[model samples]
Target: MEIGFEELPVMNLAFVIDKSGSMNAADKMGWVKDAFGIFIDRVRDIDFVSLVVFDSSAR
Candidate 1:
């Protein structure tokens, strides 16, 4: 089936992450960063994404 082009509703997403001492184990922190990068790349094609990481403070 063929579909027509149309404007969809806008969406906002927030990713809250904790970069505490526990996140330092098993390279989990690095993995998180990499995964975020990949996520940005993928979502960049469809929607706008915002990333927020929190430790003792928020960014």
Candidate 2:
């Protein structure tokens, strides 16, 4: 039996990021950015991506 990759559904991903003062400690925020860059590069063109960042306020 053979599987059809084209028949699979597209992926939707949402990432919530923390931007508070604590995130600046020990370069935690830098790590998050680097990880996110790696992830976004691996996603297919058909995939959807959304990001939400929060600190004292969110936008």
Candidate 3:
């Protein structure tokens, strides 16, 4: 039995980050950065990634 596809589908990923004043507490921001780095490394070559950071408002 074979469980594979001839072509792989593209993936779209979005990451939302918090830039509020509290994020700096206990190296929280560092953890977030590390998580994002790992995610980028694991994504497929044909994948699309987007980032949205919000503190008071989103841009």
Which lDDT tens digits does candidate 1 get at residues 1-59? 65433354445678888898899999999999899888776553456677778889898
Best by TM-score: 2
For model 2, the stretches where C-alpha displacement exceeds 4 angstroms are 1-8
> Which wins on lDDT, candidate 1 or candidate 2?
2
Worst 10 residues of 1 by lDDT: 2-11
Compared to the true structure, candidate 1 yields what TM-score? 0.67
Tell me the lDDT of model 2 at 5: 59
Over the stretch 5-43, how does candidate 3's per-residue lDDT look in tens digits?
A: 435578787888998999989999999999899988878
Q: How many Å off is the CA of 55 in candidate 2?
A: 0.3
Q: Report per-prediction Cα RMSD to one decimal.
A: 3.6, 2.5, 2.7
Q: Write the per-residue lDDT of candidate 2 for residues 1-59, one digit (tens) a residue.
A: 77665655798889999999999999999999999999988778898999999999986
TM-score of each: 0.67, 0.84, 0.80
Best candidate (score: lDDT)? 2
lDDT of each: 0.76, 0.91, 0.86
What are the clashing pairs of model 3? none
